[model samples]
Target: MPERFPGCITRVRGISAGHFTDTRRPTGCSVVIARPGAVGGVDVRGAAPGTRETDLLAPANTVSVVHAVLLSGGSAWGLDAAGGVMRWLHGQGLGLDAGSPETPARVPIVPAAVLFDLHVGADPARQPPVCPDAAAGYAACQASLERGALAEGNVGAGAGATVGKMFGMGCAMKGGIGAASVTLDGVTVGALVAVNALGDVRDAQGRLLAGARTADGAALRDTARALLAGEPPAALLAGRNTTIGVIATDAALDKAGACRLATAGHDGLARAINPVHTCADGDTLFALATGQAPAPGPGLNVLAALAAEAVARACVNAVRAAASVQAGALWLPACAQELPVAP
Candidate 1:
């Protein structure tokens, strides 16, 4: 967190993590809406995806200020959890018809994404179906908001996140949600990333900060180098990765500008991730304006640039805040240890 990024709007109210797979594995991360909804846009760069409600964010859509954002494991099946969020938001009366009496109705539009975390090698027949704990986590976030306190690390959507999947899960490292904020001029831009990429993790300088070795200290192969040699093998074709994130700013943006800002924010992902936005990876970025503060500049390009830079800082901070963990036999190192934080 930097002094430049401080602001009264767009505060992270609460964070909740839980396990929602019948596999009894951790794979839930839920973020509650702390700020009033503003304009929203989404940019999906990956070929294979398990996304929910991305179309609603398009410029043609009518909804704004989604009640919640869900990031979880269980692949495409996890999209069902949004129903729970909708039910909760309906209860809060935070939907579109907050005060409309003529046609009072509620729609707690929620956008969600999922990562592939099937119990590989285990009995597929014995594995349980997707659970509703992700929704429970959302409820917990709402509760945490009332009580106060937001926990970080290996929780929520980061529960099953792993990085460096170029050689597959056996060689990947554990990853989780990472947050970073930066202040430029007088506005604050904040980023929260659910890091589950299929490539090696790096810092702003492009160094291989982490995920180059195996859990047992064995040297790992470089997926980037392999791609240069030839096409990826069939075994690596699984939808094993994606990185989902949200960029929050007080600056106002129209639908097109917000979309452009979301695309520009990909630079931050490129800066922090090697071989991003691949066919097997569904990398998406969402630009959100809470309307608490107005865009400082008169032009959309300037505001877009600011949003992009903020996104980049957030991506960098995410890698910096990630913790090292051992999944199965893989030993992932903490981002803080791999790349020292700036002074």
Candidate 2:
């Protein structure tokens, strides 16, 4: 994989990404594993969010090592996957060293979050919930244990993802997972994101890439504009949209720096996803450092900048990699087929 893309995320030592999906229902989960345990941090922006172990990633948190980070579907229920991950790590004897005769010497720390993908596929009443659980989480981890090229788009937590629902599902489009990596000198940064937002998706150049469309599917439409007009084609929802992801690097960094890096990582989401972090979304990002490279003398400023770029690139890649699908009253247009949205 490195021979083709020297900047591949898997090139980082002791890092692997895996995804598990139930395509029948359009819901799944993605796992990012740092077997050596990387310093981790998180930043949450959306008003309605679902998460697990985010507090541990805070600067004030006592724990310093995070064994894995899980991004999944099925709203709060998806958090169940974390337990499976913890058990897997514990079985492997990987985690914080507690060093006690009574209790296990090591306990793995696995933080997780989920996006709402229930609105897609068939009606909510008729379908069984597809949120990833202990079994699914364990399966994804076992698959991820192997280091290799990671797959993106229409997988993991993004399987049932859709965007531009400000005007409701009728105007929404399909969203998926995207990934990108960068290497410079001795620093390497990579990002993976599941693109699911309540607004349109865009490119760094500010061009409309994929989004809501007119009734006839003649052209794409601006979701914000429709909302600003003081009317919506469909009723707005409370918490069915979000964009979740992780940014990782080999540089040495503390929990605080990781927190700051995660904070800065939002710029990438803001850059690529129009009208982000709305009340209905659960936008979140996690940053981790493997400490393979020397710690920056400053606040890891250069790597932070690169982290933002990596995220932006990943966002674009997600949109580009997504395949169009029909969900309820909406029809998503793949990036490859995206024509100019109506002005």
Which candidate should be chosen as best, given TM-score against the real structure? 2
User: What's the true lDDT of residue 53 in model 1?
Assistant: 82
List TM-scores for all candidates, in order: 0.81, 0.91
Over 4 Å off in model 2, which ranges? 1-8, 122-128, 227-233, 294-299, 327-330
Q: Report how far residue 273 has shifted in candidate 1, in Å.
A: 0.9
lDDT of 2 at 83: 81
- lDDT by residue for model 1 (53-119), tens: 8898888777655555666666776666667666766676666665467866767667777766553
Query: Which 10-residue window in model 2 sums to the lowest lDDT?
Result: 1-10
Cα lDDT listed for each candidate: 0.61, 0.79
Off by over 4 Å in 1: 1-23, 32-34, 98-103, 119-125, 130-134, 143-150, 212-216, 219-222, 229-234, 294-299, 329-343
